[model samples]
Target chain A: MPENTQEGFIDQQKVLDNEEYSIKNTQSIIQKAVDWFRARSMFVLAYGTGCGAIEMPPIFTSRYDIERLGVVGVATPRQADILIVSGYCSYKTLKRVIRSYEQMNEPKYVIGLGSCTINGGMYWDSYNTIKKLDEYLPVDMYINGCMPRPEALIEGFVKLQDNIRNAKSEAGYIQYRENNAFYRANQEKIFGKNTTPTFEENFAGMNQ
Target chain B: MFNFAMTPLGNLFFGLTLIVFASLLLIKNERRDLPLHILLFASLGVIFYASDLITLFVGWEIMSWSSYFIIAKSARIETLQKYIIFNLAAGFALLGAIVLIVAFAGTTLYGEIDFGKVPEALRVPITLLLFVTIAIKSGIMPFHYWVVDTYEESDHIFSAILSAIISKAGIFLFIVIFSQIIGYRYLHGSLFDILAWLGVITSIVATFKAISQEELKRLLAYSSIAQIGYIVTVLALLEGSGIEAGLYHTIIHTLVKLLLFVNIASIIYITGKTKFSQLGNLLYDYPALFILLLIGIIALAGMPPLGGFNSKFLIYTTLLEKKKALLLVAVMFSSASAFLYCYKLIYGIYLGQASGDKEGYRELPMSFYIPQFIAAIILVLLGILPSLGIALFNPILGSLGFEVSSYSSLFELHTAFASFNGGVLMGLFGLVFALILLLVTSMRSKAVKVRDRYDISYCGETPDPQNNLHYGYGMGQELRRISFIRVILENSTATYWEHISKLSGDSSVMVKKLYSLGTQYIGLFILLFFTILLFLGVR
Candidate 1:
């Protein structure tokens, strides 16, 4: 990581797929069974960040019937599994969304729902919305569209479920733990001293 | 003359409440007003054992005044005024009923004064007056404005007693007066119907009110009102099983409140915070208290394998037996919403994230755990063997002039429409619980335990310890947006009661002018008296 003294921030020159940052899950029979069930039953916390939220209702309702694929919407983060960041997240929304995501239990995933989450879509020049979702948090999967249709959303769910089942890539929650320092550094750059809690300052002594 | 008689209903409530009082004695709090607690309990005994209206009235007055003084010790002026005013009004109502009964029957003794001997028109008024007194004490709707304030302002330990045992004094009075004094034939009409409706409405409204409360004790206060509402509704059936169900529920509520309030008192004693927003994440530091509260909530929500479920089961069966589908549905709705507040009670104090500085908290004394464990164990035993409760109530039911409903065994409880075999229910619940526990433990190796509580999935940002992460305060705030709930939550009888108080205040001020010694005022009073006399003479 290169320090950018001019902006007092880290230079984001390296791709997120740095080999040193790769995370993996241990393969076992019980682990496979657990992952299969968890993949099937995804409780999505569909946080509507931008226009993409308009597309979620149809996917959840009779048109798509996402419930058939064992994906359901929950009211609280305590019971949620997958958090859907539905388009570009403003700094304010990002703070709350991060808070909601942290409240969720283990074995959780994040899905960057639209093109804005990829490169801030049309608002890349806006002062608020972050361009890359993965810079502040782990993005387990991303579906491409200005606003993904219900069909595309369902397809995204399918691909994510397949990834979860096969353990094909590092899970977002595991990466969050192993490379938390990097993510926290990026978050602090955007949020300054007001960033969410740091693991070292807040939680380090408590973990015995 | 001191005359005392024991009935099944009275014995059951008095004995169970005595158990609660005994449990209270186990707590070694600084503000344990031991003498007042004893006075309150002894007065309850007097009310329950009274064979005459005079003795009941005496006992009632003692109980009310003792509790008022206890509350006055730490309560604010406004809270004390509300408490005393309502209680005094209830005391007057009871006295008026006694006077009316004496005027008609020419005696105060229960065995001597027969409702049949009284004039037909006087019977309804007498019953209603007595009903009003009970309603006020039990904190029934419209008459319940004083309860939350009193509960909130009192010492937490005393709040437990007030909720657990004192409120039940009204139910005891109801059972004795309605069943034995007034008799069912006089009450098989619109009067009891009004009471039944009032009870259900109170529960529905109180359940919603309880959900919106941010203060822990105030929430429990509303919950107490709701639970007592169910008992009142059941008591209105004027049937053997209905009374039994009411008694059963009364016992369960007493135990649940005692356990919960004491557990909360322990938390408050340690942390010195009363609002849900001010407290959080004490589960690890006080894991035992957490489990105790969990048990309290489990029973309070009336889940299986606890005495709460047994009582609720009885209440449902009685309602169904009476063919009250609508009432049953309303009761179920209230029960369902109760889950939200019950979850809040546990989640607010223990789980989620620590909201404020918990460093100031210290270890709770062992005295707190003694009462909690006692209540928890009894609740479990009653859940496992409900027959014990029925057997105790059988003699009381027989004494209440109703045929004792027989159980097949020590563990089976049967009603006309349904039966609950406690042994079987307990066995099945235990078996399923054990299997799930075994299965979960077997897979424990595969499941990674996140060592850090703060190490939760956040979109990609870390969570600040200072940030308000515990949703305890906001848990039920959104319920206000629901149309039906909004209607109930927005409309309260407080304004009506306030108007009544203002009216009385104005009348008292006008009367006070009559005592003015000014010449003009005195001459005006004389002129009004002569004018009234002249008008009467002309007529």
Candidate 2:
């Protein structure tokens, strides 16, 4: 087999035409463009749960004016590309996060807020708190701080945009979807069992 | 030996092995309900002992996942999702920081990666990463969502372990980076002040939140956040005394939370009623248990003559010396709030109106009660003799190389505690209190009436048939007075997060428009691809 870095080897093998991007310089070039566009495409989801949520106001409205950078906040999961787990969750909130994540479409990203969501922060020992957020779903970025500073959050935004632009994720959403059943099952497992009348009715009727 | 992979490896391997063993020997077969806890503890322990960054991270991640599974196993999937989302967010942030640090540090080894070797620019970001991870785990304000829900929904004993042990991961990480690697000197001490407010505000908000909750588990959860706020506040101090106070609080909180959760366990098991609105009049059946609960609640409330008071005193003294006046006020306010909740806990569960007519409310298993019993006794013993727990914890602190305090003068309050003649004061106060109580009793007539329905929040209306009104009790009711405080603590951050999700959805929508006829997106992608190639060629 020819070395991947060597032109003679890869060209001769003609390994399924899908490998075309790997051999070309265009991928890097295209990435640069994506990043350029991503930098300007500033819309953010304000998924505040913890104290980190506190910093967003100054950043978005007055102090930092993240809006100047093209970042405006959104309101619903369906309309969002980024899901921020602003703080830690109990068994109860985890269910809603899953539902929200399910509602989000492709090319989605998740940003965690505050230290609590990171590893239960200080409540790491609390029997009610989950230690980390990533056990159940994918995360794209994390804004550090018990509640991250507005600057740090801005930094997080830039880093995410950079990742989005640079990632060689030209492949369709099929790969992302294949492993999502665990998420669905996880969502079902929690939602299916809530005894609250509102949810109970949904569980009984929605399954059919 | 404590390599990056090793820590997570230890946790992952041990977690699986224990789960297997629990399934085999403990339950002897298919899906025994027991393996859940053993797996949780084992995984958590291995993660704690993890030696390096990646391994520690991996172990931490896996343990978190497993614990989330345990909590979600309760079937309250909504809370589980919040739990999962919050944890994932923090985990990703930690990972981003770790990845960046590794990129700069050139290694993932826990000890080998020296911050000094890295470029000046990267150190603050790395410290921020570690700090954030710890803060999230610690349930510092804003980050404290998952703790309450998971605690409320999961098994009572599970909540106990979670509150007692797993939560320390945040402190462990804090110690790892804050005192150890970062040196707490970053950004010219500016960040410290922010962290300090983080603690103070969180304390105020969380305490208020705790006071307002009605459900036993939810109340416990908020209380848990308030306690964690104290710990974070101490860490923000960055002084030896402050660190000591924080560590001391950690130790006390660990004991107090364990006992409290165990007490909760006993109640949950016996009555199966989880909310304050549902439970009542348990003192008649379980006198011994009620006494234990009282002690636990007292200790948790930071009342005198208990372990809670000693630690609270230390924290209060430290804050005062640091001159964190607002925090001082917050601490006192939170304590006062504690009295209300603790009173509600007792009255609502054991002294208020009983919900059912069940004559046979049997006691929980003796095994289940053992933990609570041990916890309460220790709380009392530690309260009586703060030196005992302090002496024991000192060695652990020493081994961890934490600098101990020599500030005898700091704790000396409005007249030195040692010199103020505490014994004499106690005797005088006891006599005054007793005399006052005796006078009040003598003054009261035999026809003094105390009715159940007269409580103010409950006074508003009767139990309506259609919608059971949730009388905003505790901090919830109190929040109504301070509505303009921006005191909305629910995950309102999602409004913006969802907006971002929408943009991504919009991106997909745009792509769909490009290919709505089943070939738009694909064709556009192709057209865009070729257009770029041809344009570049033209250029």
Pairs of colliding residues, candidate 1 = A101-B457, A102-B458, A137-B460, A197-B463, A197-B464, B8-B396
**Separate DockQ for every predicted complex:** 0.13, 0.01
Query: Second chain of candidate 2: TM-score?
Result: 0.78
Off by over 4 Å in 2: A1-208, B1-32, B186-188, B396-402, B406-479, B482-539
Give all candidate RMSDs, comma-separated: 7.4, 35.7
lDDT of 1 by residue, B218-255 (tens): 99999999999999999988888888889889888998
- Scoring model 1 with DockQ, what do you get? 0.13
Number of the predicted model whose TM-score against the real structure is largest: 1
Superposition error at A208 for model 2 (Å): 67
- Model 1 agreement with the true structure over A81-163: per-residue lDDT tens digits: 99999999999888777777766767789999899999889998999889999988899889989877888899999989988
Quality class of the docking in candidate 1, CAPRI style: incorrect
Q: Name the TM-score of candidate 2.
A: 0.58
CAPRI quality of model 2: incorrect
